[model samples]
Structure formats: C-alpha cells, structure tokens
Target: MLSKLFSELKRLPRYAILLAALTALGMTAGLYRLYAGLGATTNMSKVFPWGVWISFDLTTVALSGGAFTLAALVYVFHMHDLHAATRPTVLFGLLGYSSVLVILFFDLGRWDRFWHFIVYPNINSALFEVSWCIAIYSIILIYEFSPVIVERFGNNRLLEWIKKLTIPMVIAGITLSSMHQSSLGTLFIVMSPRLHPLWHSMLLPVFFLLSSIPAGISLIIIGSIVSDMLFGHSLSQRVLEKLGWLMPWFLGLYLALKLGELLVTEELGLLFSSGKYSLLFWLELVVGVIVPMILFSIKSVRWNRWGTLTAAMLVAAGIVLNRFDATWFAILPRQGVTYSPHWLELALLVGVASGVLLVFTILSTYFPVFVETMPTRKPQEAAVEAGRAERAPALSGD
Candidate 1:
C-alpha cells in the first residue's frame, strides 16, 4: 500500500506541486489579511478602494461569460453541435466565479459583514444589483454543472429530472449573467469624474456588455485548445473554427461602438493626446481587438489550429487589459496619493488563481467534463457487435 501511494505521488507533475504550494501560501496570507484587516494587507484607500482584487474580479467575470454564451448557443439557439464544448466551459466558468468570490471576500474591509449585501437591500445601487446577480448566477452555474456530478453516479432518473429543468435554468442563468455584466459597466458610469475620458462615456454599460461576448467566445476557444494539449480532451477543430468565426462580428461591433462613442463624445484627440492613457487604450484596442479581429476574419487564419489559438489569446488578453484599465489604471488617483498592491495582495491573488487551476485539473481528470471527440471503435468491431446484438434474443429464446 505504501509503495503504491509513493508511486502515485511520484507521478504528480511538478507544476501541480507548485500550484498546491502557492495555494497553501495564499490561504495563509488570506487568513492573515482577515486577522490584520485591509489597512495592513492592502494598498487601497478612500481614493482607490478598488485595487488589483477588483480588477481581477471584473476580468474573471468577463472571461467566465463563456458558460452563458455557450449555453445560449447550445440550449437556447439549438446549436446542438456546439454542445460538446459546453460542459468544460461551464466548469471553467464555475471555477472562475468561485475565485472571484474568494478575492471579493479578501477585498472586503469588513470581511465578516460580507453577507450584508444579501440581507440589506439597496435596489438603487448598481453594486447591489451586481452582487445579487453574481450570487444568483453562481447558483445557476452549480445547477448547470450538477449533471456532470449526477452522471458519475449513474443516476439516470435524477439526470432526467435535471434535464427537464435545464432550459429554464439556462434562460435564468443567461438573464442574470447579462444583468451583472452590464451592471459592472454601470459601476464605471458613476466614476466618470474620476475615470479618464478615454475610457469613460455614457455608453459604458453597452460597451462592457458587447465586449464580454467576444471575450467569452475567445475564452472558450482557448480553453478548448488548452484541454486538447494538456488532457487530450477537446472539441473538434471545425467546431473551434466555427467559434472563431463568431469573434470578428462581435469584435467589429465593439470597435464600432467604441470609435463611435469617441467620435460622439469628441474624445478622438485623447486617443493620441492623453499620453500614457492613450497608449494603454491603443494597446488593448490594436493588439487585443483590431489585430485579432482582422486575423479571425481570414479563413486560413481562423481554420488553422495555431491561428485560431493566437487570435483567441489576443482577445482574452484584450479583455483582461480592458477590465484592468477601467477598474484601476484609468481611474485618476487622488492628488498626491497612489495605489500599488501590497506583496501579500498579489500573493493571495496568485494563490486563488492557482487554486482554481488545480481544482479544474482535478475535476476534469475525474469527471466526464470533456466530451469524447475521438472515435472509440473500429468498423469491423462495430459490425460484429451489431451481429451479436441481432442474434442475442434468438439465442436466449432457444
């Protein structure tokens, strides 16, 4: 027994061990932060209450949009072919949101009062709406992912019951996701005075919602590629190409809205004149949006494995930059004060991220999260199996 256990431990990957170590350190840091309070652990203040944690939370939530987008495509739009990618994407989304909730807990100054938002209602507040939506949507994700669990137990009856409610749950999940995704943008609308003009506008909510679609699609594409490489579990290349095909339209729309808003608001000059802000904005737009948009528009690029992966990575990177710019970088720091996340803050963030990856690795390893994309049987074998099945009743009767 001891020898078998040792052999199993020896087979564990070096990276998995590193992730476990980081997660352990992160947990220690998180516990310390809760004991020491935000003042001691974070670099946030009245002027910069939203720091790296908030930026990470927003970015994660945006990327996690894949779960709903894929769900909508499969269940709502009847794109049954895309169902193969839905389970893994949903699991990714669940872990992504789980990390967001953990980071939010650490970011809270009054960590013990985290439940205040639930019991204390504030309909007028955008944050209140976001809180409720994220909370409800997380539950919806669990419900959506429950089938993966029930399947392992061979609980066909329970699975059928869950399947019966699947459509309604998916609809509810989509609705909740849309609400909070837009509401996250609504958060910046109120900060217009403090936020740079390059990023601020009356249509911030619309911009956010539009951008998340491509971001979600990009994440799904990337996740598929990664799973294929790491675990040999993934959707077909043609399916990935189809997903890539959707990117250009959404990216183009986002580009149009962003440029149109700048034109309407007369902030085009700021695109060049705002110094570092201009550079940051263009970094996200050109590399993250425009370049990937042009690449995805090309048939050869979208069809090639590496090409699609590259485009998806760019789009995902762009979303992360856009979220960070809106949440932290673009926000004007008060007079002489500036915010840089403490080392512990970053450590905890790393830990939470690593923890999610670790969990995903374990789940995907044990669960039938990835659909079987490879053929399992040869033609001769299948023919012989069918022949046996055809004669089974006659043989039994004899």
Candidate 2:
C-alpha cells in the first residue's frame, strides 16, 4: 500500500505537488486554529467581527454563481450550444461552495454547532437564508453533476433516470442560487451605519446579484481556458464569445444601479471626496467592471482567447475586491480597533483554495468533468424518450 501510494504521488506534476504541500500545511494550521479557538488564532475582535474568511466566503459564492447562471442559459433559456460549458462550471461551483462551507465552519466560534441553523431556522435573517440556500444548492450541484459519474460507469438506465430529474433540479438550483446571491448583499444591509457610504445602499442585494452575473460568466470563461491548458478541454471560441457578450449588459446594469443609488441617497458627492474609499471603489469598478465590460463588448477581444481570459480575470478579481471592500475595508472601524489576518488565517485560506484546485484537477482527470464525455441528451429529448418508453410498454400489452 505504501509503495502504491508513493507511485501515485510520483505521477503528480510539480505544481500539483506544490498545491498538495500548501494544502497539507494549511490543513495543519486550520486544525491548530480549531484547537486554539478563534481568539488565539484569529485577529477578529468585537468591533472587527468579520475577517478575511467572510470576505472570501462572499466572493466565492458570487463567483460560483456560474453554476446556476449557465444552467439558466442552457436549460431555462434553451441555449443548447452552451451545454458543453455547464459541466465544468458546475464542478467549479460545487468546489467553490464546498470551500465556502469549510471556511464558514472554521470561522464559527462554536464550529461544532454549525449545523444548528438546520434545526433552528431564522426566517427573517439574510444570513439564515444564505446558509440554507448554499447548503441545499450544494446538494443540487451534486445531483446536477451525478450524470457524469453515472455515464462514467456506463449506467444508461440510471443515467436516464437522473436526466429525467435534470430540468426540475436545474430550476430549483437556479432559484436557490438567485436567493442567496442577492441575500449575501442583504447580509450587509443592517451594517449601513458601519459600512462606508460609497459601498452601502438599499439596493445592495440587487448590485450583488447583478455583479454576480458577470463574475460567474467571467469565471466560466477563465475556467474554460484553464481546462484547455491543463486538460485539453476547450469550449469553442463562438460559445466563449457568447458568454463574454453577457458581461457588459450585467456590468452596465450594475453600474447604473450603483450610481443611481448614490444619486438618490445623495452619496454621489462621496465618490471623489471619500479619499481611500473612493479609490477602492473606483479600483473595483474600472479594473473589474469598466475595462472588462469594454473588452467583452468588442467583437475581436471576445473572440480572442487570451483577451477574453484577461478580461475575465479582471472581472473575477474585481468582484473579489468588491466583496472585501464591503465586508472589511469599507467598514468604519471602531476607535483603535483594526484588523488583519493572522498567519494561520492566511495559511488556511491558501490551503483551502489550493485544495479546491487540486481536487478539481483530479476530478476532471478521472471523472469526465469536461464536456466531451458528459451526457448529451437534451431535456426535451429525454422527456420524449421517456414518454415513448412508457407508451410502447402499454401499447405492447394491447
């Protein structure tokens, strides 16, 4: 067994090995944090309750929106050609949400009771809604990803059954995702007093949901490029261009809403006067939204793989920065109360992220995560086949 393990380990590329090493170290740090408690291992305090973990969780959830966004386009909106991108996007979403759950567990002071929300529901709380949506949607993602596994095992009958459930499952997943994506912003609504005016607004939930559309799309574009480079699984340029085309509309809507809110709330003046907050705000918008929006709008850039990839990276980074701004940087700190992540916090984050990437690589390598091997039955076709099967059996009895 030891020899076999060594042989398998030897097959990993240098980057995978590095990722594995970082994951191991991070896990060790995470374990120590659990033993020592948040107070000992984290820099969070009464005034600075949320640290990097919350920011990461929010950012990840937003980016992971690709799973539902793509599902909607392919299944709900009947954009059949984009089906090829859904499997990888969904797998990324599953891993992204799984990472969020793990980080949330560690962030909890009483990590043991992380499951309490399941039994003791909070109907009015945005956090409660986000929690349920993420948990249930993760299960939905697993369900959505199951046909690939069934296909790998050549289980045609079971695969058909799973396919039969696909439409309803995709619908449920989309609905749940929409709820939580917006609700994440709603989580900060109560903090309007502490959150900087430049980043705060009554329309935060709308901004979050709108921005997620572009972020999710961008992640899918980037994921396609990475999959091609790493595993030779590439979505066609036309499909990628179509996906890229979506960014400007959503980004534009987000921009309009953000500016409109500031205008109505009379916070527009703060845009230039808020010093560093203004810079942070513009940094997120220009680099993440405006540049990518323009890049994606251009026909040539959208068609160019490297151009799309660069724009996508900016969009993803921008959304992540926005999350950090809202959750940490934009908050008005209490007198003499400041926060920075401890080394352990940083280690755990890197470890978790590294672990997700490593697992994505292994899973894609083994489980047909790319589009070529995924089941290709459209929902309508599957339904028709099921109907024919049912009718044929009954007719034969006559």
lDDT score, candidate 2, position 30: 94
Per-residue error for 318 in candidate 1, Å, reads: 0.8
Q: lDDT for model 2, please.
A: 0.86
Q: What global local distance difference test value does model 1 have?
A: 0.86
Over 4 Å off, model 1:
1-14, 374-398
Expressed as tens digits, the lDDT of each residue in 214-269 for candidate 2 is 88998899878765544545788888999998889999988888888999989889
**TM per candidate:** 0.91, 0.91
RMSD of candidate 1 to the true fold?
A: 9.1
Tens-digit lDDT track for model 1 on 247-332?
A: 89999999999999999988899999989999999999999999999999999998898899999999999999999999988988
Worst 10 residues of 1 by lDDT: 389-398
